[model samples]
Structures are given as C-alpha cells and as structure tokens.
Target: MLDDLFPILADPDFQKPGSGLMSFPAYVYVYPPDEEYAFREALPQLQERLRRPNVGQNSLAVNIYDALVEHLEEKTLGGRPLLDRILEQEEQDPEKVDRQVKRHARSEEFVEQVASRFSAFAQEEGGLDRSYVFVHGWGEVHPYLRASQFLDLMEPHLRGYKVVLFYPGTYDNGEFRLFGELSSGNVYRASCLNERLEA
Candidate 1:
C-alpha cells in the first residue's frame, strides 16, 4: 500500500529539504487512513495540474498527507483525547487547545514523535514526501521558530521545504505571526480552506 502511493518520495531523485526551495502551494495533502484509496486514485491527475518541474528553480512542492489515525493508540487518560497530555485539559476546552499544543511541541523531534505515536507511516513516507514538519511547543513557540535551524539540519537532506503551523482548535496565533515576523509572503490558512468548517 505504501509503495503504490509514494513512489516519488521513495524514489532516489526527489530533492531534500535544505538543497533548494521548491515552488509554493506545495500541497501536503494529509488524509487520515480510511481515505487512502481515494487519495491514491487522485494523485496522477492532481500532480499533473500543479507540479511544474519546468518552471522556477524547483517550485511545485507536493506531498500527500497519508496516515492511519487509529495507529496512534490515542486515548483520553480521563475520557479525553490523548493530545490533552500536552493541553492538560478536557479535549473540548477550546481556549486551552492552543496552549496545550504549544506545551507539547518543544521536543527535538516533535513531528517525528507525533508520527511515532499516531501515524506508523511518517518516517518512511516523510522521506518519500520530502516532508517539512510543523509543530508547536511550550507556550507560543510559533512566533520564535526559525526555519534556519530546520534548514541547516535538513538542507543536507531535503534541501528546502516548509513547516506549516498547527494551532489545534483555532488558527489564532501561529504561522500568521511567524510569517509576519519574517516578513514573508507565503503564509496560508488551513481553516479558511476547509469548506466543511465556518470561515
């Protein structure tokens, strides 16, 4: 199943994070496990539309967000989602969502750790997808995260990549602030793009 969908990531030719920047709108389409076949069937058509190997230096970054949700073995210590381990509150606590996500994001391998706990496919697929992991940690680390650290470490691997910010419940104070601090033009909002949710 993994081999059929992530050929680009598994192949030997894809660029690593630090080597060079891939073009924008790099779609890291993360689909929870059950949706695998639908996503797999759509890949070639989707890639053909947006991927531009001929345009800009290496623009046209695209990665499929493939994972199994149940593999995470996530459960509530007290009838709440395990994510509360970091949030330290009931899963329904909206205000604490952001705080909790940040509290737990300070690890040296935040995304990798999340993958370990939740998604079994992260490590291998990460390399295949040329994934740029995003994580929050220890109270508002979002504003201070510098890709340079990632770029320094990953340049040798991914060459250039992206790290989207995840704010759990709301998108209040994350990548929006980081991009503003860096004065960059590339910050995007996932909430607005979700047609299923209110914008």
Candidate 2:
C-alpha cells in the first residue's frame, strides 16, 4: 500500500487541470484514526520520497496542529497569550473557556493566520506551482474547526498547487466522516487519493 502511494503522488499530471475527479488539484488521503501513529512515523520518509527525481525539488508538509498552536500563542490579550488568558479562566469557568477557545478557533483571524502560515511555507519551499503541499494533523484541531471547513477556507490559497491532506478519517464520494464516525460534511472539490490507490 505504501509502495503504491508514492507512484500516484509522484505523477506530475496528478495536479494538472482536468485531472481525475476534481477540476482542481486538491486531494484527500483518508486513513483510519487507529493508524495515525504509523502514518506519522512514515511522514518523513514520504517527504523524502517527494523530493526524489520525478516529484520535484521537495514537498511542503504542513502540520496544521502546529500552525494553530503557533497562531494561538502569538495572539495576545493584555500582554498575555490569548490561550494563557483562557487558561486563567479555565478553573473559574470551564465551560466559558471551552466556548472562548471554540470561538477563537472558528474566528476568521485564526483561519487567516493558519492560511498565512501555509502560504508562507509554500512560498519558501519552492512555491505552490513547483511542489506538493502535504497537510495533516486535522484530528488535533477538530471539534473547533472541521477538516471540511479548513479545506474550504484554504481553497483560494491553494488554487494552482497540488495538495494531499493526510486525513485520519473516511471520505467516500463527497462525504467526509472524520475518524469514520463524525460527519465532517461533503467536499467534492478535493479528489480522494485513496480511490486512486484502488484504481
């Protein structure tokens, strides 16, 4: 299964216009949540493979979990990280803290921050046109932000680039069921790389 994935990912035409299911080049690679560790273990090797001859200079692998954390840490309220302020309120009102965090997660500010990080990484790592952007860690940033929502927000930023979302979930047809249970919603624009593997 691992061996087959490389050839599919390395295919230069995979991201070209009118390729496969999507008119755009975005893709979702669903895997069982139980196997997240295994996938993480193989991530470096997968990145290395993308840097090999046919795949281009190198791929930009962005763990959105890290991006979100960095964004939260950077955002300060009254000379303290917003998350720290939230932490201070946690004991006094746990529910309020949850709501506040969730609110922040769904904020345009947070979305833009994460998107900026992605674009910066893409630009620094050979730009979108010349490389693949492998996005993962959606599970960690869940409940607050759905994979469907993040991908939807990221669509404009990723217009010309090929993207493979290493989603720890299930995407059948246009519906995405996170962890194979929670319905993340329908997303038809991004092709399913798992389907390509079966093909």
Candidate 3:
C-alpha cells in the first residue's frame, strides 16, 4: 500500500490545476500507530525512490521535527527568549515546565512562525518539482502542534508541488483518528485531502 502511494506522490500529472485531486498540495498516508518506527526507518528508501530520474522531477523531503526544533532555537516566546523562558520555568517548576512550554508553543503566532520557517526551508532547497513533508515527533510536541491545525495553516502557502503527509493515524468514515489516541478525538478532518482520499 505504501509503495502504491509513492507513484501518485511523484506524478506531476496529479498536481495540475483541476486534476481532480485535492486543490491543496497535501495528501495523507494513514498507517497503524505501532508501525510509526518502521515507516520512519523506510523514509530513506522512499526518498531514493522519489529521487529516481523517471519520477519526473527533483523532489525534496523534510522531517518536520528537525525544522520545528530549528525554529524554536532561533525564535523567542512571549517577551523572553524561548530557551530562557523554558529554563526559567524549569527552575521555578520542573514538573509543570513542559506543559507551560507546550502551551506557549501552540500559540497561533508560534504555529504561523513554524509554517513560515518551513516554507523558507522548502524555498532554500531551490525549485523542486515536489516536496515530501513528514510529520513526526507527535509525542514530543503533543498538544502543542496538532496535525490538523498545522495542515490547515500550512495549506495556503505550500503550493506548486505534490506534498504527501505520512500520518500515523487512521482515516475512516470521513474522520481522522490521530495517533490512535482515543482522547485525541477522531472528529478531526482535513477537508481537501480527506474528500479525495476517501473517494
């Protein structure tokens, strides 16, 4: 099933305007939560496959975790520097510091910053025909960055490529069950991607 999806991802024909796929340059590959490690380990092979000359054009793959960490390191949160705030919170309340940091991390401003930084990273890779963006480290960011929220904000700026999001979740009956966590709610949906994937 994973291999089947790769051709669709690398095919520029599906990326054209009114190609019957989603307008937004995003697609989701649902997988069992426990298989996350295997899927990540296979990324290099997948990247190699997508890089083949016959795949049509040069493509770039980015692990969002690394991008997010780089963004956090370079930016500030609230009025204080991000790292400084986290350290201060840790000293004042070690147990609750993570929660505090997550709360700040998920702020609209911060999420937009992340989106912007990701766009910049993609642009830096030069003009590629497609981009494969992997959204991992869900456990590390948790409530700070929900997949749906990030995609919704990112859809606007991420254009001109066939972008596939490898989601460790289930897609069923028009809803998304994120990370297989019951508490996370299966009511979420990415309208553009879901409508076509479900078809």
Q: Identify the candidate with maximal TM-score.
A: 2
The candidate, 2 or 3, that scores higher on TM-score is: 2
C-alpha lDDT of all candidate models, in order: 0.33, 0.74, 0.59
lDDT of 2 at 55: 61
lDDT of 3: 0.59
Winner by lDDT: 2
Q: What's the C-alpha lDDT at position 108 in model 3?
A: 64
- How do the residues 144-180 of candidate 2 rate in per-residue lDDT, one tens digit apiece? 7777777777766664456778888887767878899
Worst 10 residues of 1 by lDDT: 62-71
List candidate 1 stretches off by more than 4 Å: 1-75, 83-99, 114-199
Writing each residue's lDDT as its tens digit, candidate 3 over 87-174 gives: 7678778768767656656566666775665566555654444444545555445666666666776666565444556667667665
TM-score of each: 0.29, 0.86, 0.72
lDDT of 3 at 193: 49
Q: Write the per-residue lDDT of candidate 1 for residues 146-190, one digit (tens) a residue.
A: 232322322323324543322222223323223223421223422
- Candidate 1: C-alpha RMSD after superposition: 12.1
Residue 6, candidate 1: C-alpha displacement in angstroms:
20
